[model samples]
Target: MKHKSLAIPYVGWMALFVVAPLILVVVYAFTTREGGFTLDNFSNMVQYAGVFGRSFLLAFLATLVCILLGYPLALLLAREQSRLRGMAMLLIMLPMWMNFLLRTYSWVFLLERNGFFNTLLETVGLPKLDIIGTPAAVVLGMVYNFLPFMVLPIFSVIEKIDPRVIEAAQDLGANSAQVFRRVIFPLSLPGVLSGVTMVFIPSVSTFVISRLLGGGMNLLLGDLIEMQFLGSAYNPHLGSAISLVMMVIVLVSMGLMNRFGEGEGEAVLL
Candidate 1:
């Protein structure tokens, strides 16, 4: 009874904040300024379909890059001794201690035409690379900001894996590659799925990173939605519609990832 009573505040909080806001968004998404029900907001999304496509593509690329880069790093960290492992995890998490916006804005200084890397190349008499205000910059920003999300989850999962299991696989004639391919990789699927969900959801809906890194040249669905509500367009209804769609897409993607992860987990158990 005490535990059940303690849940009352949390339930009230969710109802007041999360549920209420979602309900408001849904209401606004399906209504006009004149308070009449309509489907025009969804119909208008067709014109911005390209933006949505690009957003998802960039997000997918970022998630893939994170997996490729972070998995190896996570494996290395997970293999380290306790003290060394703690230090490595600290280094991975250090960047996150700073404000998220500030961390992202730092990339602006690094990737801009006259930024640090370009200046270094100039001093070295090498041709300066132009990546700012491009899709590449957006992907870079996403990866840089979100890589830790991938690394941490994978590292946690890998660290929890029983060492006896690996030893047993090796005793059964499994080589390092076979052990990883047949055991470690399969066991880490949950972490990979979690990392993907963490990175992809934010990347797909990010406006600040795209705007700051891409210099407004690469507009995403987030940018489009922001424009409707806060930019010169000022169409809250349309913004709500886009937000609702984004929410649905994220929910569906997460469901797919969960299902896929479960199937892989079951296969590995078998």
Candidate 2:
């Protein structure tokens, strides 16, 4: 009875915030301003398919980059001694301690035409790179912001692995490459999947990064949805429709990750 009672507050919180908001989104998505049922909002979403595609593409690239960079770094961190590991983890998390918006905006100054990198290039007589207000900038921003999400989960998984397993593999005549390929890589799938989900979902749905870094030239699914509700359009119904579609995509992605990660155990999101 006590345990059951303890869940009451959490259930109530979910009902009030999560469930209620979802229900409202559904209602807004499927109903007309006059309160009549309709499907026009969803049907209209097809017109913005290109924006959705671009969002997914950018997110995919960013997640791939993070994995490529983070996997090796996670391995190094996982193998570090306790004190060194703690310091490395702190450095990885340092950027996250700042306001998300502030961190994103800082990139603007670094990548702008007259920004630090460009100035350095000019000083060195190298051609200046025009990266700000471009898709490359959006991808860079996403990777910078979300790379830790990829590293931490994989690091946690790798660190938790029993050292005995590696010794056993070596005793059985397995080489370093074979041990990693057959054991470490397979065992780490859950963490990799979790990191992919963590990075991909937010990257796909981000509007602020695209808006600020891409100078509004890159229109993602998130930007489209925001425009419907908060931009000149002011159409909540369409916005809700887009939100529902995004939710479906995210759920599908999570389902795929869960399927692949089965038998490896659940991945720690943090």
The candidate that achieves the highest lDDT relative to the unseen native structure: 2
Could you say which candidate leads in TM-score? 2
Counting clashing residue pairs in each candidate, in order, gives 0, 0
- List RMSD in Å for every model shown: 2.9, 1.5
Candidate 2 ranges beyond 4 A from true positions: 268-270
TM-score, one value per model: 0.95, 0.96
lDDT of 2 by residue, 153-241 (tens): 99988889899999999999999999999988888888898889889989999999999999999999889889988897888998999
Q: Which stretches of candidate 1 lie over 4 Å from their true place?
A: 263-270
lDDT of each: 0.90, 0.91
State how far residue 27 of model 1 sits from its true place (Å). Answer: 0.4
Clashing pairs in 2: none
lDDT tens digits, residue span 1-270, model 1: 758989999999999999999999999999999999999999988988889899999999999999999999999998887798888888988999999899999999988899999999999999998999999999999999999989988888998999999999999999999999999998888878778878888899999999999999899989988998889799999999999999898787777767777665332211
